[model samples]
Structure formats: structure tokens, C-alpha cells
Target chain A: MLISSIYKIPIVILLLSGSLFFLGLYPDISTIIGGVALFLIGMEYMEGGFKAFSGSFLEKILEKFTNTTPKAISTGFFTTALVQSSSLVSIIIISFLSAELISLTSAVGVIFGSNIGTTTTAWLVSLFGLKIKISIYAMPMIIVGIFIPMFLKESSWKGIASILIGLGIIFLGIGYMKEGFEILKEGIDLAQYAMSGYAGIFTYVLVGIIATIVIQSSSATMAIIITALATGQIEYTNALALAIGANLGTTVTAVLAALKSNENGKRLAVAHFIFNMTTGIIAIVFIYQLAELVDYIAMIIGIGIKNYTLKLALFHTIFNVIGVIVVSPFIGTLVAFLNKLFVSKKQSKGKSKYLDDSALGLPSTALSAVIMETKHLYENAFGIIARGLNLKKKNILSSMDLDDVVADLYTSDTIDIDDFYNYWIKGIYGEIIDFSTKAQINMAPEYAEELYKLKLANRDIVEAIKGTKHLQKNLLKYTSGRNRYIKEQYDDIRKSLAKLLRNIHTISTSNEEDVIILLLSKSKIHAERDDIIANGTLDRLIRKGLINNQMATSLMNDSDYAYRISQNLIAMAEVLFIDIDSDLKKLHVDMGISDEEAKSIVQKKDHS
Target chain B: MSIKKFIESVKASLNLNKFEQKGKKKAIKRLLQKLESRKEILAKIHKKKLKKKDLKELREEQEIVDLQIKKGKKLLDELDG
Candidate 1:
């Protein structure tokens, strides 16, 4: 409470100060401020639209391209340029890094490319923003965007609508900004107050940094700078200084974001901070030389000398590219340094690995985080279930002989499954359910359906754990030198389950669709082998007077528990691993045996 | 025109409904190809003469794959319709 109060003080004071200044410079400043707000809102809409493209589209590209540093850099560059949201790209990268889906070095390379990619926005605002009557395009785009989803009714169409609306609003905002500056120019020639040399550059740079920090988007700040420059509201040098400051401001956001992130996240944030800070400082130091280079480029490209806005955009791109060139060789060193600096705290095994509040900004990242965390839960449950069955998980995961795997017991004593569940499975399970609920709000209908299935899959995991816990009680007691027939039955149950575990492990690891299909069918067949009642194996044991009624009851109940565990695990696997973005995913359910089909297969086996 | 009428006109002109079916058809075709090869492999293994239990499991797998191929073909025909 005290910390939050203290945090609000600075925000309150900033708002009050802004209000006082705005009061002095009313109406015109209000138009300008409102325009900035519209610009930010437009960007929010645009990012939201682009995020709808995220799912396997971006994940596949990043996965395919991020094997090497250069490949990663190009992937990051092209993706951000196309998406128009470096922050969106960054969010996904951070989420990926946390998932350990992409490596740290590759993530850093992508961030570098994104910095250069963001410069395209400056080019866009300079080239087209001040030229045409944006309002003409703006109004029609808004109308068209509003009507698209009404007619089409697809998430992709909604994404298209959002983008059109976003571009319309952005253009409209720029028009308002141009008008506000023209109005403000009559009363105050802000250019008259311009300072020269180092003093002027430093002051303008500081102003630029503050503007970017306030806006939380350097691209928006750059747009404002370009618009103001075109309207004769600011000198070119001062705009350049502001550009440098805007670059620096991104670091502050990264630093603040790092405060709450996990170790890998913090490391990535710090890498971002270092990259931006280095780029900013280099831009500041080479302001003059680079300004001349921009002029030379302008001449070569046929942009007029007086086109300060275009020059500023060119300068922004040049420095970022130069920064990338200078920094590329040192990425290895930086990664090593960052790894040492932000070591992970003694993280509890129960803590959610991928679920973080930062991921909530986009539906795709949030879903990925949940999926990754669920897999983590599956890993822990896999360990517990193996132990519960009195078999070493390693042996099940390995290419060991099945009889040998079952022969090597996991524990001589009864395994405390409830304790293991409390320590590992319970907390992470709660987090996934809670995170899924939050992610559901912004999700499209398709994404919502996926999330719903995920929740069911998670429930299946928990139930499987519970079933294992139930079966563990009898497993240890019966497997210990009991009646020979009951002992054989229990041993058979252990061997069959070990086979199930091994198949599930193989299914989880294999990518060949046919292999996955075959293994899944085989797993179902093995699970059915546990139904002692359906096959009358239990009845025969009782009829032959081999085991007592108490033993019969325990064996029957334990068999049901074992069977349920297999059913739950297979159900979970079908959702988690089999459901993918491929033709096999489409055919998997239909091709996969239904219960009746499995029963038929079982009946055939019994007859044979 | 009603919204539904407009939607249908747009969909009809663009043939957008066919896009998913096209992809599904392509997928089924690929799966059928793979399933055929799996049947061949299973047949090859049968000639090697496994033990009774192993032989039963292999035959069961072959049957399941055969059924899946049939299901795939049926789904493809329905899609074609």
C-alpha cells in the first residue's frame, strides 16, 4: 500500500504540472494532446489487429529462422516491418524465451533487427503523413472498417477491420496534429526559442526522451516530431536530438518491465536496455557527422535539402543500422554478461514457468504461455505417476526392456503422491486455470474454443494424478509377495502401465504424424488390457479360488483406477500434443479409434 | 438485401467456403499416402514371423490403419460431395 501510494505521487504531480501548462496554452494544446491520444489509440488497435495473425504463423517463422544469429536478425527485421509493432514482436520473443522455445542469443538478435525495423515508421510518417489530405482517406476507412466484420463475421476479417480502423484513426490524428501546429504557430513561433550547438542538442534530446517515456511509444513520438518539423514548429537539429532521446526512453520502459519479470525475462529486458542505450548514446555523439551523411543521402535519393522531416527519418534509420552493425559482434559477450548478471533466484518447482502478466497484452502470447505451463505440469505429473506405479521414470523414458523396467521398483516404501501433488502439480494447475480465464476476454471465438479444450486437458491432468494417487495405495501392498495369482495380476498391471508411459513419452517426442497415429492406437489397446472385469480375468481368479473376496475387491478397484489413469492421460495427450496446425491434426480424431472401435479391437484380440 | 443474403452472395462469388475444404482434402490425401506405406511396412513385418503376442499386436495395428484409410476415403468422398 505504501509503495503504491509513493508510486502514485510522481504520476499525480506530473498530471498536475501538465494541467497547469495546458491551461496556459489551452485549446490549441488540447487539440495537439487529443491528437496524440488518438495516435496511441490507433496504434493499440493496429497492434491488436496484427496480433490476430500470431498463432502458428509467427511461431513457425521464428522457429524456422532463429537457428542462427543472422537468420534470427532477418526474421525479426522482416516480421516487425510487416507487423508494424516492434513491441508485439518483443512480447512474443520474451514469451518464447521464457518458454525456452527460442534461445537467448537468437532472441537478442531479433530485438536488434526490430530496432532497425521500427525506423520504417518514421519513414512512413515522413513520406505520406503530410503530403495528402489524410482525412479524406480516414473517414472512408473508418466507415469501411466498421462495416467489414458486420458482413464477414470471421476473426481474420475482424482483424482486417481493426487494422483499417486503426490506420484511419492514425491518419485522422495526424491531420488534427497538423492543424493544431498551424494554429499554435500563429501565437508562438517555437522556432524563435531554438538554441544552437551542444547545449541545444542536449536540451532537445532530453525533451525527446521525456516525450517518448510519456507516450510509451517511440514511433508515435517520431511521428509527432516529423509532423511538427513539416509545420515549421521545430528546427531539424532539435528534432534529431529528440529522436536520440526517444531511442533512450525505450530502455527505461524495458528496465521498468524487467522489475517484475522472471530471470530470463529480466535478462532479455536488460539486453534491450543495453542495445537501446548504446544506440542512443552513439546517435548523440555522432549527431553532426550523421546529419551531414543524411544530407548526402538525401541528395543521392533526390529528396530536397529543405525536406527536414525526411532527413530526420533517414537519420533515425541510419544510426539504428549502424548500431546493429557495431553491436552484432558483441552479442555473444553481452549474452554471457547478462546471464551472469541476472541469475535466476532459487525458483520453486511449483512456480508457473511461462505464465506472466506481460503476456496478457496479446491473445497469442497468452495462449502460448498457458500451453507451455500446462506442458510443465504434465512433466511433473509424468514424474509422479511413474513413481506411483513403482517404476523409474527414466527407465520408462529410456529404451529399457519392459520386464526390466517393471522389475526395477521406484520405491521400496509407499510413495507419498499427495505430498508430491501439493508441492508440484497443484500450484501450477491453479495458475493455468486462472490465466486461461483472463486470456478468454480478448480471445476470438476460435481461440476461446482452444482455451476451453486446454482447460479440459488441464482437468484431465489433475484427474489422472488423482487416479494415480488412488491406485498407489494398493500397488505397494499387493505387489509385495502376496498370493501368486494376484501378484501376477498386479505385476501385469505394472508392466502394461509402464508400456503406456513409454508410448506416451514416445508420442510426446515424435513428429511423424503416422508414427503418432500408430502409437496412439497402440496406447488405447494397452489401456484396455487393464480392464480385468470386462475380460473376466478377475472372475476367473475368484472362481478358481486363487484369491479371497477382499483381494478381489481391491484388484477390481485398482484395475479401474489404472484404467482411468490411462484414459485420462490419453485424453490429455490427444488435446495437448495431437491437436496441431496440420492435416494430421484434422484427421487425427477421425483416424484415432473411438471407444467402440477400441472395444471392437479388444474383442477381436480376445477371440484371437 | 438481408445480411444473410449479402453474406451468401459474397461467399458464393469468392468461393471462400472451398478454402477449408481444399486444405482438408489435401491433408486427407497426404494421410492416405502415409497410411498405405504403413500397411506395406506392417505386411513386411508379418513375413518375418513374430511370436504369438507380438504378432497379434502387429495385426491389430494394421487393422486400425486400414480402418483409418477407409474413414479417410469416406471423409474425402463426403467432402467431394
Candidate 2:
């Protein structure tokens, strides 16, 4: 990984100084540097276009296609080529793994494929970018890219336009780079610096690594290498070494990116590092042999003998493919080692489990992480509220009758609601809120809205816990007291809440929209029935003088607390559970039981 | 042709019109089938001579399902239109 602490700035400055020193000696240096900058900028634009274009398509494809190791590798290869960015592919894979949307094995497989897929850049530069009249195609592509957006308002159109523009700019940069190397050749041949034998190969490999590290882009470096090799500025053998070095250099970026990621991302980073290191070494040790093999293949493929650019591209691809083939069989062993290498620290009850910084890289991943973390928060809140009711969580989640659940007290003594809330609710809620705030910055509008709803659902969960804390005080006092009527009423309160909890548990697990909706509607009706005043339970008890004013007041206030708990939990469930399907989401909006309908249902119950 | 026009032609050629509408209709039909099955389950329970509480809850569930089916059918008709 790139150094993150105090040494980072100095290394960057030193790399810049070294790059400038080589360029300072030549008049064409400015053009070379400018071309690199343009290449990097073009890469950025292309990555942005692909990301914008993907929306949900890439995520769905990645999820669907990564069911097996080979399929995952192919998916990784095809996706990276299509988007023209291995880093972007890596980022998405990291986010997906962090969100638990894909397995670590599948992620590593894709990373392997992306290595081969990335070789396509070298082929592109050698075949079309350098061999053609760059400006002729570049200008028209840039023009058409700019013009398409004017007439088409769709974002997808904008995405296609950006892609055209990015490709055009990349071609222009290669053209400029080709010219810079051509001019530099007249002053002094860079080929003279190329070392012979192992000494030269090792030296150039180190130079390649440094070049890629300095440029912070292996793709740009590869383009530079290919253009220079094509222009005969550097010998082909040194270019091969540099290609190996460039492969090693990209792992530095992956490692740095993974530094901010979760354990899955860290494991994948190590996997990437291992893959590249192994490939680099193997390619370096057999460089001459590999070169001869490349020549034999090139002849059969009809490439000219002097076409070192195409040969280098072929070499770049061959080594990576060899790396994949060599290392792929050991992937099972590698995954086992990596899994043991980066164990997720055993977190506390209240710690955020799914809100890691990796998922924040993508809007969908961020949203998925927040949703999952919200569920974790809900589980914690569920335990706190159930304990507040003095009901065992296992019993409530079970198929046990609600009345039986009420009788099955969690403990004989009063539970500390405050302590449980602090232990399981406070820290996680704060982290989710903080993570959501950071995540919403780059989120699409609809995703931002979903995050907003999840935030509210999180709040609703906390509010229910608070309501439980309020209800728990009188609940313990009255349920254990000598007054049979008051005790029965308290037990009734416990039963009502247990039923609500049980119904939500069912809704949470059920995918059937009808069942979820019906259960949610039934819970709403039950919540309204909890209104002691509206239901005449309070009036009748008071009229009979079954309870004193003091008891009555306690009963009234505690009933309201119980009612609030049901209300909050139901609202949270509606948001979290109903989001399983888009159709269900629309149906929930259009046909969810309104408050008035709930009241009407309770009134009908009263009449009966 | 204009880029927008060309996109429209492509969409038409792909038969990609009203993709969401088709999905919505399919979802509604699936939900209606589930509700009908649920109704049948309830009807079986109603005939079993259940206790007063069970019967009352069952009656309420039936009413809710019937109302949902009516709404679903209405929504499907509107989508078709």
C-alpha cells in the first residue's frame, strides 16, 4: 500500500521530482507529462461513465454471475474490459463483499479475471491508438460524444457520451505520447539505458514499478510503455520487465484502497497482492523464454517480427493468464489462508457490524450496508424491548401463544432497561446515523430517499426501546402485585406487545407481500385496541371501582406507553420489511392500511 | 435521425416498451393468487367451528384480504388501460 502516514508527501514529491528530472532534459517532456495527465483524466471520465451507466445492471450481473469460481472469473474479466477499469471493478467487488452480497471466493476469482481483462488496454494502445491517425478518430469521437448529450436528456445517453469522449481523449494522449517519445529518440535513445541480461531485466522491472507507482496508474504506464516500444524509444526486453513492474505497482493501489475497507476487502487486497507478486516473479524469472514463446505465437497470429508493441501486449496477457492458471488451483488454499489472516475482530453488542467504510464506495452498497446494519439495530432493540416486557425473546420468536409468552418472564427481578439500552442501542444508532450521513453525499436521489427511510426506521426502533423503558416500570409493579384486576391488565399489556413482536418477526422473514401486509394491518388493528380509554376497558374498570385513582392513572399512562411501543415497532417494520420488493413497495404506498382504517377496524370490534 | 428518436426506435425494436408495467401486472397477479389461497385457508378455518376469538380474528383477516383483492384488481385494470 502507498504510505499513509508522515512519509506519503515526501515519497510523492520525490517521485514527481524524479519524473520531472527525466523530462527537464528534453523539450518534449511537457507533452509527455501532459499526455499522462490527459490519460489519467480520460480514465477518470471513463470510470465515471461506466459507473453511471451500470446503475443496478452491473450489481445484478455481478451478483448473478458469481455463483461459481470460473463464472466469477469470467464475469470479472468481461466486466473489467467493458468498463476499462480494474480498480473500479475491485472497488465494486470490495463493496459487494462487505455488504455480504457476494462471497470472498467469488471476489478473488473476479480479481484474477480483471488482471487478464486489464491487458486489453495494452492491445488497444498498440493496435488502434498508435497505428492509426489519432486525431482523425479522436476529434470525431470527441465531437460526437459532446454532441450526443445535447440532443438526448437521458442519463444513459450522457453515460455513452462520456465513454466516447474518454476513449477519444485516451487516443489523443497516446498520440501525444508517441510524438514525445519519437522526438526524444532524436536527442538520445532511451534504449541505451536498457540493461542487458538479468541485470537489465531487474533494473527495468524496478523502473517499471517506480513508473507505475509515480504515475499512480498502471494503465497509463502501460500505454506509455507500448507507445515508447512502438516508436523504438525503448527495447522490447526492458518493456517486458516494466510490464511486470506495472503489474506489481497496481497492487499498491489496491492495498491502499483496502486500508479503508472491511475484512473482506482486506482479504481480497492480500489475494490481489499475492496474485500479482507471484505473476511478476514467474514472468521475471522466465522473461527470455516468455519472449521467445511470444514470438512464436506472434508469427502464428500473423504479427510482424518487428511489432514489439503487439508482442509486449501479447506478453502482458500471457503472463497474467499463466498467473491465473498457475495460482487458480491453489485458490481454495489461498482463501483458507486469507480467511485465517484477516479475522474480523469479535465486536461488542452495540458496535456497527455492517457500516464499514468499504460499502460507502457505492450508493447501492452503502444503502445495502445501512439496511443490514439497521436490521442489526432492530435485533438489538427487539431484545431490549422483549426484556422490558419481561418476555423471553426465544418464546416470542417461537410459535408459542402470545398468552404463554406473557407468562414466560425473562427474569424474576426487575431488568435494567437503561443498562441494556446503553449496551446495545446507543452506539450502533449513532454509528448508523453517522455512516448514513457520509453515505448520502454521492447517493442517487432514490437511494438517498431509501437511506432517509432507513434512518427513520432506525429512529423508530430506538423510540420503541424508549417506550419499553417507560412501560417496564409499571409493568413489573402491577404484574406482581396482589390486585388481580390490575395484574390481569398488566399481563394483557404484555400479551399485546408480545403479539406485535411475534407478528413483526413473521413479516421480517416472509417474502410474500400479501402475508406481510396482512400481518402489518392486523398489528395496526391490535395497536388501536391497546387504547384503554378508547376501548372502554379503562372506563368499565373505573366504574366498577376495581382500581383506585392512583392505580387508574398508572394504568392509563402505562397503557399509552404500551400503545406507543406497538406504534413505533409497526412503523419500523413497515419501512424495513416492505422494502423486499419494488412491487411490494408501490403496493404498500397505495394500499397500506391508513390510521383511520385502523381506528375503524377497532370500532367495528367494539360494536361486535 | 435525432439521437432521442434513434433511441426510441431501438427501444421499440427490442420490445422494451412498458417493461415496468408488465412487471407490476405480474406482481399484482401473483399477490392476488396468494390472497385467494389465503382466503381458501381462512374459509377452511371458518368451517371448523373455531372458538369466538379465533373466529373473530379470521373474519377480520377475510375482510382485509377481500379489500386488498378489490384494490389489486382495480390497480391492475388501471395499468392495463
Segments of candidate 1 deviating more than 4 angstroms: A1-31, A183-188, B46-48
Per-model TM-score, in order, reads: 0.91, 0.86
* Candidate 2, superposed: residue stretches over 4 Å from native: A1-28, A55-57, A60-68, A96-104, A127-165, A179-196, A256-265, A296-307, A336-343, B1-46, B49-51, B76-81
Q: Give the clashing residue pairs of candidate 1, or none.
A: none
Q: After superposition on all CA atoms, how large is the RMSD of candidate 2?
A: 4.7
- Give the top-scoring candidate (TM-score): 1
List TM-scores of chain B, every candidate.
0.90, 0.75
Best by lDDT: 2
Q: Per-residue lDDT for A46-73 in model 1, tens only?
A: 8777777554577778778998989888
DockQ of 2: 0.31
lDDT of 2 by residue, A124-198 (tens): 888888888775788898899997666554556677888889888887888778888888788778888777899
Clashing pairs in 2: none
Best candidate according to DockQ: 1
